[model samples]
Target: MSENETQAEVGTTRRGWTASKVLIAVVLTAVVTFGMTALLVNILERRTESAQPNHNVVELSDTTYDPAVWGQNYPQQYESYLRTEEMGLTVYGGSQPIELTPSETDPRSVGSSSRLEDDPRLRIMWAGYAFAKGYTHARGHEWMLEDQRYTVRVLDFNQPGTCLNCHASMPEVYDELGNGDREAGFDTVNAMTYSEATQHASGPVACIDCHDPDTMSLRITRPAFVTGIAALKASEGIEDYDVNRDATTDEMRSYVCAQCHVEYYFDGDAGNRLTFPWAEGNHIDDIWKYYEEDGHIDFEHEITGASILKAQHPEFEIWSQGVHADAGVSCADCHMSYDRSAAQKVTDHHINSPLFDANASCGTCHSDDAETLVNRVVTLQDRFVVSRNQAFDALVSLIYNIEEGMANGVDEDSLDLAREYQNKASFYLDFVYSENSYGFHAPDYTQSVLIDSMDASRMGELALEGASREDLEASEVTQKYAQDIEDRSDLEFLR
Candidate 1:
């Protein structure tokens, strides 16, 4: 009896031991699984933190115009912003500091003996304008103030305070003007002479231009941009629109850049007030119409007495016509590509062409590698340059013919008509010349504008002289340009 009872108790004890072991194993497995997951999560969090920039150094003031002051708070952003001083030139465009000595001042010495001299034709095209004094490619934001200050165009002091609108830290100038009140500084600065305004000029395009200090949010600080955005909205029939209040975040990404990278003129009636001619539209022809309707001319040509308009770098307007804008890509998307450093991701403040950092800029979206993307951009630029040269040639010939007619005692009435054509031709040509993108922003739109310029120039030549359109078109330059245009005509447009 004792053996049977002992055996039953041992079997039950064995079963209980087995069940306990199984339970213990299940609990241990659960614990290990949970521990591994926690460890993995912790590693990921550290990696994320390592990749992000998280500096909170200082409280930036609303009136802070010094990039150094802003840099103290956002070191990564400030460091990148400082990169704008890097002046590496590409084939069609980028930045190169030009030195104009006393010897290089002669208009005839351009592009021949002087490395910095622009094309010889620019001298005649911009005759009677400040540009004829000097023209150079724009560099980074760091050089904005320095370049404008040293340019021969500013030596005579003929330009007004409005000229500093794009070149200097407007906020710094405004602070001085408004006695520390940035809001009031704008109007005060606008009323000053170029000589006086430059006294307060600060280096580079600063943070205050595009950011709100209190919140550090991207904002439009320039008064002209505020007005221009409103006008742009009004033209689009968007009622009650205000940039400060109504613009979307994506819109601001592009709008903030539109502040300086646009076409503008100084008002004659309002003491040369900085103005965007978007009163009509942003299209090339639209601006042309704006000048005619407003009877605004940048300068009266010395030789032909033609009142001509100078096209500023209208990157924003031209980009608006491109595929990037259509696809909702903002200027900052390419130019100010997001950068990662020290566990921080900030918008690259380099503010340069996409070509500068193709991988980060174009590679983010483009399936093509950097080399292919660059080649594509170069191809577009090459097409633009060919047409651009042809337009230049036609305009130069037209200028010569008009001058000849004026000298030959062409009737005042006919000369006036010819002058009008000259204005159109010059505007068309200058539109291409001043644009920094080399028509890559809107290839189709660029070609159309150039063709118009070429046609108008030829017409002006014909009007001044008895030469037929066919005769004008038969030139080697025109023939070569026409063929290039034709070849690109069928190619799919980026816009």
Candidate 2:
């Protein structure tokens, strides 16, 4: 063939190739568009399904204690709630039971090489209080009533009726006491003895605690929460704040959990009235100051003789300062996220640490995969463990130092400041120690708290060595606080 014939043939081949490519691209585009449209439709369908409330079962009473009654109407949520009975352990959180033994040489050490070990310092710190007798690892919400009934802290110690505030189906008790008058019910129940209150616990934490029966709109049932939140708002300069009226839907998601999972105390003078010490700010220091200025000592330290304060579960308070809260995430956002597939969508009421269901909990907001998020969480917890242990070691040393100074004939006046240091130091350390998060909830805040705790512990130790209050207050830990260096033979140290 000639050169012109060859060029014409080559041009024809090129044109044919271009035509084939265009046809393939059109087919691929149609498939991609169809897939995207289907995905969008499915998402919208799930949203609509979840948005519509469950309306299948019978009507429930406002004061229903049995979750099964609520379960009848909301089977998915109720069934998920039952999973709290599962004793499965996550990496850092969960109520997987671990055996703890009081150390043979040191009864104060509650952990026998397990995380369940109650810091030995806790015994010293909570001395003369019921917690000193019995404190255990916190379990799931299902055990709220069970734990309360059986703990030595309750049985051995004389807990008032106010103890029932968070552990029982409080709505039912309220109804029984006030003849269905919720407000009047609170006053009546508040006056009951612990034994009388025990008779009132119908079941575990139930739907009525956080919901309005007629509408199923979230409502605060506990009277303490109503007053506590009002006080909290007042502290923030909001007058006459009513939770049922003032709280936004987004705020209700968190406010519901905050009802129970917050720091509280029994107001001994006025009929053991359950109180949230939020008249001050929610910070560790703020609460401490409130306790100090108000002369609200939980117990006198039997060993150090310092009037000490006890912290309850303050998850909501501490978490309120974290990045998640700042970014508008609620407790329910992670703990009660919706689990939707092609068929159904509803909130998973299996309330737990977000670490348990990373895909639904963390992955919902995070771009990372579940495994990455889990690992990231584990790393954060590990950091807290190191800091917490450091603080713990320092605290134990301080306790021993104070005891030693007392044994060596240190004057009560000079050692009085040491006792004061021990009081503040242990409170700081125990605040983090008792909180269930292990520091995953608020990493930066957790670290700063632990750092201050370590500083206080070392200061207490130095005060035992004749360090002045000014020096103790200004001093910082330049080295590792000593650990497990206590003399076991000393009578005061043994106590």
Candidate 3:
């Protein structure tokens, strides 16, 4: 072909590609938009015969922002965005000034607990990872991105490209690093590090927390979830995540928040940063069952590269199985309760525990007095709290025993038993403690903790039996307790 003819062909191909790209971008941008956002309104209309208010929304005076824009489109959101900065020192769950201590709050926590006080089995379980270095719970979305940004040497973050999928500004990552190729951007950032990419992320969880600012619509910013859903569908030969059909409006209320609230982990083994084991189903048993069956997990130290299964907060999913979700209530319905103004309305974005505002959260639905509902939640919470309290104490003892076995040169069998006791016991207790809802509010989970704790204690006794005291002392996994790696023990590590 002539050079002129070749150039014409090239131009034609480029034009086709460009058009396809634009079309794809527009369609994708629309898919993730939030359906619950306040309806858009025309501001400059005179009191006329045809104008009608269709939604319950607040009336705006002239201009705070342009509704046509994305980020600036939601002034109500912008106004409520400031709540993240509010002081919640006293607010146990959602209050701002949350200074948590593993010891002060729950002395039986992983690092602080007496049960895991000195067991080295975890070192094996979390081999070659920072979790081995010592992991803590204060790492919220806000904190994880900060220190990681300033750190010189960062995490391997490469174990699963899926780790960085959602904990980022999807658009920005997709742009600077992704080269504007939607598919390529996901691949690039999926493989990027929290440390390397954090320099690019500065804002707290907000509009882009679970959405793309290019459109003021709710969108799934996490690739792991998006891909997970697709993979789940593929595995089952299904392809529908219209979030709408999966649940009710109330379920979406919480599922919307669950968009960020539930448990998840970087699946290094599969090289896929997958969400929980939900493909099998969504309850605690279902997810755990999926994990056990697929073995899709890190199973390694998150920091030092050990094998481990990092159980994220399964509150939303677990709650979905509870009376709240079963009754058709959502996390948003309670947490982001709504209020109205100028005939317009909006759900509060403060995002706090419902217990803080009983009337708005519980009273709105149940035909009970504020005190009664408060008592109901508290009663449920307290019931489990008691069992959990016992479980916590038991777990602490289990850790100490495992540490004792390692320290006392116990036999291999006994040492193994000690390790098992501590790991399972502590993990079980921590799982319940971490649930965002207090026990009464999330009863089954609370009960599950107690049951699991009992199992851990039982198994712990077996680990203690695995080793002779002398052998345990010689082992590296346990060397802290030179005395009494024996019969039943007590939890006293934090003290």
* Cα-lDDT of candidate 1: 0.75
The local lDDT score (0 to 100) that residue 211 gets in candidate 2 is 83
RMSD value for candidate 3: 14.4
Candidate 3 local lDDT, residue 296: 57
Report every candidate's CA lDDT: 0.75, 0.74, 0.50
lDDT of 2 by residue, 1-495 (tens): 333543353233211224554665457546655666666576557658666444533546664455665776687788888666444567767765544343432222111123325465566667678777777666667656656765667667777788887877777778878898977877777778777886866666778788888887898887788898898788899999999999999999999988888888877786777788888778888788888877777778787777777777889888887899999899999888896562556888888777777899976778898889999989999999999888888877777778788899987766888778777877887788778888877899989988888877777777777877765554234322222234444557555
- Which one wins by lDDT: 1 or 3? 1
lDDT of 3 by residue, 316-368 (tens): 66675577766777677777777733344566776656676778777667778
Model 1: residues with Cα > 4 Å off, grouped in runs: 1-52, 97-116, 180-183, 340-344, 465-495
- If scored against the real structure, what TM-score would every candidate get? 0.79, 0.80, 0.64
As a whole number from 0 to 100, the lDDT of residue 341 in candidate 3 is 35
Off by over 4 Å in 2: 1-56, 98-121, 342-345, 470-495
Error of 2 at 191 (Å): 2.8
